[model samples]
Target chain A: MTIRQLSVFLENKTGYLNEMLAQLAKYNINIIALTVADTSEYGIVRMIVSDPEKALDILREGQFTVRMHDILSLEMDAAPGSLSKILNLFTEADICIEYVYAFSFGSKSIVVFRTNNRDKAIEIINENKLKSIREADLK
Target chain B: MPREKMRALQTERLKELVNRVYNNVSFYRQRMDEAGVKPSDIKTLEDISKLPFTHKQDLRDNYPFGLFAVPMKDIVRVHGSSGTTGKPTTVGYTKNDIDNWSEVVARSFTMAGISSDDIMQVSYGYGLFTGGLGAHYGAEKVGCSVIPISGGNTRRQLQLMADFGSTALACTPSYALHLADAMAEHGYSLSDMKLKAGVFGAEPWTENMRKELERKWGIKAFDIYGLSEIMGPGVSHDCEYHCGLHVHEDHFFPEIVDPETKEPLPDGQEGELVFTTLTKEGIPLLRYNTRDLSTLYREKCECGRTLVRMKKITGRSDDMLIIRGVNLFPSQIEHVLLELGETSAHYMLYVDRKNNLDTLELKVELDESKLTDTIRDLQNLSRKIEHALNSAIGLSVKVTLVEPKTIARSEGKAKRVIDNRNK
Candidate 1:
């Protein structure tokens, strides 16, 4: 139903993002999904991983402005219309979508979105009986 | 200057100055009559507020001799400001006015504890700027061997200080820093010169700068307040205590007034400084608004001067930035940023009107090491900067962390404010 997304502050520079990924790789922390929010000067990396708490501590030790934000994670049908069907519920409710990123989970696809009203979006997911992912389910 | 007598003499002189301006200068006369303020309305020093407020534009409208209260034959010397904007605001000094000017400057020098035995160097610009001449006359009156080396010619400025054993220096605070640095480059140490005291003015300077000069030369740094319109360079001088500058109230009556309302603010309140030339004979102003923002202290300083003292000028009303109804100065932001010590002193304020709302953006350079390969590091650092600046200025400012050397460095009087909103 929900997973904590770690948002990392990074300057928009080459080899810097690779350096961070190398750090995560050294810790053997597997990633679930990652997306970047960028401006001309800097960029923000939002990631969902196998272990968020451990990743947060590791990044905090690395001296980063790391914080956790609850994001709606759903395992929808792999069919094409299935994606639009889940998004249509949020569109009807006028819930603003900040950004959405997805990754595959075997036969099912894992999709998460950042929205203005996450609780309401979650409510819509439950009322419609859409399959939702949980934190433990990621492990 | 006793306390009771100071008030009595001010009351007496205020009445005379009001009449002189109202009768002799048409600009003052019309403005006074329009405000329904008569010369008789002023009976006390506090009653001086009833008179009309004068602005720089008022002088511009009148141009040259329009504001002079005395006749041309009586005007012995004319010193005009370099009109950077429009016509240069011209000020006249009669034979009596020059004497009074020199007398007040001499008193200011004495207040700064400068003695006749001290060798004084007047480095302030001599020509149109009154700093060099005003300081020269006062130091001369004090019987000190005056070094009339005007501004510029830094090599010679340093050469003279070393050769003549210049004991006191009078120049802009920034120029003083340049001279101090130049002395080192010229292979002259502080031991080589005999600079005992410095009276820095013609620009606003901070306590931090004073401490720097004090450490650099091992001398006392004093703030001297003045403007060309009222009197030159010696309008007020700080005593040994350095609590505040003791205004030469007998000659120039100082008043603090709200810049917008033109109403006199009570003592201890910070506002635009207004002055009435108490004994200025050539061109007496009723209440000339200086636009320099500072506070006045009525309490007697530890130096025991009965004259009113004023805080150092921090920012001018014209330099104030009104962002979303919050009043702020770029100096305040620079202060907090420098105090944090993580960033360089270089910064640029970009103010723009976005979406019909005022937006303030402070772009500060981040030391490369502060940002590791971590993503959240810069974001958190920027948030911390935003919080500090918000607390300092009480306005939520958008903070942008740029790479070092991105912001331009200034050689003289750093350009801090960039108002893109007007464009």
Candidate 2:
């Protein structure tokens, strides 16, 4: 139902993002999926990387404000209505999705998101028999 | 008193002060004995150099009551300045010492042209700190309708100024500005109040600040200089002429000594300011090095006071930073950081004046040991440091966490303070 994600604080300066990415690239830690929440003062780079534990150590060693958190990733069919169906479960359950990002691997689509309700969302997903993603599966 | 008569009186008092301290205070006794100088040696004002110079560390070394020239039974009150560590460097005052303090403050008010008809609002903080009670007693002695309303509570300050017609306001120059801003914010202009004179001190402020304060309140701003170690905020004050502050030479004798060599400099030469309490009975310090840098002018002031005038203090010989009237040291900040064991020794202090208020921003390096993966942890660490610093220095410090190597380093000496204040 969930995989580890790395969130990093970045100053809103030019080439700062590149500097963070370069640190990861130097350590051979590949970023799988990423999204950035930005404000005028700073940015939070929320990312799922190839080796999250190793990537956490590397990014922190490079002096980045990095944190690790659990985020839910749902596997779905590669269709136009796939995300709409998965999101409708949360909307019907009155669970608010904080943020969402997606990518496709062959015929299967994956939607990774954070939500306000974690336990209830997990129960709904398990009861509905929705295919859940794990950290091992990502690795 | 004329210059010659004042020096003669000073010489007489100097001999008595040396005898008092050498016979009463063991600390001063040992220092004088070690220097091989006897009380008889201080027969004239020129012989003050024969006595050993008292450093701030001497006060700390004596701690609570070791430096007092009189017994605890004779001491009436105590005041102190916060030290780098938990212990405060304390000073005690006898009943007569308090009277002298009041007299000096009264004289200071008189110098500023404040009279018994005026209403005075004393805004300096009370408690063990000397500013509040110091000015309060002086204003009371001057027969001014005294408002002992200590620092803060700006709306009430302005309200009292309007309702009670406070003619004189006394506080740090910065707080006076803050009060002015607060008055404006509360829709009360200068015309609404009856502030005629402002006695500003406890912190070093520039002439521009004096001009701004005068302009803001439409009052004549006067600079009053004093430290808790030397009797509080009435040692010297500027007259209506707005020249250098006139020292009350009859009680506290002022001298300029080279900061490095510790040799007496000429009257006009800029050097460290030193004072010898000619009349203090409780803690009679003989030639105490104040660490303040200023010049002394023996020339006759146009206002006709023959008392020696000292220029406004330019800087400190030490690294003590006065923020909002609270004395702080960089080593104190480092001690807090070390005690927390959360930050690297490398840190920098950024001091700036924001909206006429002093702001102390501390930038500490986050080391690997204290580094955490959560923003909450970092925030908590910074807050912890802020709380520690606030408790240690009695001043609110803004703590900022920077990368370990972000603060600039130098080979000669790592810079610790960046004071961006206009002064």
Candidate 3:
């Protein structure tokens, strides 16, 4: 129902992201799905990795501002209006989508997002009979 | 006060003050004993040079109540200035001390022609800083309609000025300019209020500032000077003549000394201003070095007062920077960073005047061992440092988290303070 994500704070400077990714690569950590939320000052590098606990320790030891959080990932048919259909359920339920990103594999797409009401969003997925992905599934 | 009479009174008070501190405060007693001087040594006003000068560090070393001349029960009020570290430079006042403080303040208000009929709006901040309550007490003594509206809340300051028709304002010179700008931005005109005169102090301002403030509000702006250690804002004030500020020599004696040599400079020679609290009961100081740079004048002023006059403070001999009326030292900022425990002490302070308001921005180097990838965490870290500094110094500083090792490391004594306010 949820996947572990690593969020790192990076200043909006040249090669800052490359520096962080290089550090993760040093530990042989594999980045599964990644996205960046940024402002003029800095950027938040959010990623789902194969080994989150090891990645967290490595980044923390390197003196990086990093944290881990659980976000929901839904597997949907890789088709037109697939994201819109899933989003409509949340909009009708009055549950806010804080942020959303997607990655595709085979004939299906995995949509990752954090919501204002996590418990309610989970309940909506269950009632609507949606396929929810987990950390093991992403790996 | 006439010249001869003023000198006689100062000599008498100086004798008493020396006797009090020498007998009560061991810090002062030890200092005097080391200088091979005694209470009887201060016979004339000139004998003050024979005594050792107390530096700001002396107050820090004495800490909270070590330098107080009287018992804690006798102290009626306490005020403090920001120090370089955790402890503040504390000053106490007895009942008689408060009365003398009110007298000098009332006299200062009188110098600017602010009287009983005028509605005085005291915009200086209140609480431990001393500016707010100092002006409030003086305005009450003058029998004026005292507003007591402390600093900030610009909209309310303008509202009360218009509705209450305040004729006099007492605040920092920069704050006065800020208020004028706010008034215009809020669609206010001078005709809407009855503000006529302003008494500005607590920060070093220039003659050009006096002219600018006078033109902005169409009011006569008078400079008032004092420090919390020497009884707040009533120690000296410029008379209507505006030649120089007339030191309330009857209470606080003023002197000029070469900053490096510590030798007393002659009258009209620019040097560090020093003071001797002649009548203070709570914490009587013996030739305290103020560290402020200025000249002294003993000539009879055109306004007919014979009190010794001190020229406008040109600058300070130390690295202390006054931002928005709050005395700030770069060492204080460094102390905050070190206290934060996560950030390095390596930092730089950029001080600038934005729209006539003093703005301080602190650039802190992010520790390589504490890099967090989330901007939220970084924002929280910066806010934490900002809150700590604000509580410590009483000034809101904008904290900018810079790249690791981005702040250049110097060979010896890092040039931390980059003040652009003068430019």
| Per-prediction TM-score to the true structure, in the order listed | 0.59, 0.88, 0.81
Best by lDDT: 3
Predictions ranked by lDDT, top down? Answer: 3, 2, 1
Give me the candidate number with maximum DockQ: 3
Better of 2 and 3 by DockQ: 3
The digit string of per-residue lDDT tens for model 2 on B1-423 reads 877887888888888888888888888889889999988887778888888999888888888888998889999999988444667889999999999999999999998889999999999999898999999999999999999999998888888889999999999999999999888788899789989999999999899989999998999999999988889889999998877999998999998999899999998999999999999988888778989999999888999888889999999998888888888878888888888888897899999999888999988877655543344556777899999898888888888777667788899966799999985
* Model 1 segments more than 4 A misplaced: A1-139, B320-423
Q: Would you list the C-alpha lDDT of every candidate in the order shown?
A: 0.81, 0.87, 0.88
Tell me the TM-score of chain B in each candidate.
0.76, 0.98, 0.95
The true-structure Cα RMSD of candidate 2 reads 3.7
By TM-score, the better pick of 1 and 3 is 3
Give candidate 2's error at residue B246 in angstroms. Answer: 0.5
lDDT of 1 by residue, B202-238 (tens): 7666788799888888899998888888988789988
Better of 1 and 2 by TM-score: 2
TM-score quality measure for candidate 2: 0.88
Which residue pairs show backbone clashes in model 2?
none
Query: CA lDDT of A89 in candidate 2?
Result: 88
